[model samples]
Target: MQLVSEFRPKTGDATLDGLLEDAMVRFLSRRPADRQDALEKLWDAFERVKTLEGSNKSVAVPILLGNAALGSDPFRELLTDEFHLLTRVGNNFTIRHHEIGKTPPPSDHARDYLFVRLASVVAVVLRHTGRMA
Candidate 1:
């Protein structure tokens, strides 16, 4: 699977940007034979982007995604539902929950698909937030 060389979203938050870059590095590395590890890292990156403007508050993903500070473009408006769905997918299948034997693990293809989705979301968020020119 092809991976982005860097996950630099540039949300004006240094820590969050660093976290995303780290996650991207892990996802691109070949050491993670188990797709779960890459998914977990990508999930962490997603959560960090979501909470970028929350000041560490326990805000819902939808609320974070809808924040006016992000932008009011039509694309941002359209992304609201997509963000929620991604959150649900992450919660259901990844390490966000301890389902262990209860939930089936994601296949390599599924993991690659999710990675692309997440990369798109992060890129959109950065562009909308005026972080990306």
Candidate 2:
């Protein structure tokens, strides 16, 4: 398990950050085809990371973002796609999936709420990872 603290975001490069976030979003998706497509993006992200000084803390953020994305239940159950970026960051950082909210109400509205909440997390992660927010 990689510690959350170990993952850092690249702070100064706006363009690079956006690319990483886009890659992460694709990787986080719960589809095989999407995962495969995201892998290339992940490679690009890594290239950006390599450009940073080894001492930079922000370099680790991709690992954290990938873990969080892959750890989500839908992504994990597929048992096929793995988060390569997360592994490279180190085993110290671990991504855990938690029920984001209380037991949903028995109505259709509940599902909508859950979707909104999850989407919000994704958005935040993307903005943070991309350095756009």
Candidate 3:
């Protein structure tokens, strides 16, 4: 499967779009550091996109995700779960920070997996909120 291609969507917010674009560009590098950077930027964008709806972060996330409005209950649950998982990975890993106990992604495959997984949810939220097109 393709992680990123020529058809990346616009996130409307210039900063957010740049974050996503930069993440994709960084992911193109073969270096492990670059992949980690990609996840960092993607996660940053993910947090910022949740606030686009004028609601507080906690309230806005569910609105941004949209409850059962995308298609069905399963899809909604999947998206919500994915978002939470991404957030947890960011918090627990060395992608964002390297303080004391955070662990870096084990391999190149794992790094790539993280970048793509996080980016997917960020893109979906942007699209659902009309921030992406």
Q: Which candidate has the highest TM-score of all?
A: 3
Model 3 residue 52 CA deviation in Å? 1.9
Per-residue lDDT tens digits for candidate 1, residues 15-97, read: 76776667676677666464456567667777777776664635644555565335565655677767778778778874566
Q: What is the lDDT of candidate 3?
A: 0.75
lDDT values for all models? 0.66, 0.42, 0.75
The candidate with the higher lDDT, 2 or 3, is: 3
Tens digits of per-residue lDDT for model 3 on 64-85? 6773247667877888898788
Ranking by TM-score: 3, 1, 2
Give the Å error, residue 2, model 2: 9.6
Mark the regions of model 3 whose C-alpha exceeds 4 Å error after superposition. 1-3, 67-71
Question: What TM-score would each prediction reach against the true structure?
Answer: 0.71, 0.34, 0.86
Query: Higher-TM-score candidate among 1 and 2?
Result: 1
Per-residue lDDT, model 2, residue 77, is 33
RMSD (CA, Å), candidate 3 to true, equals 2.1
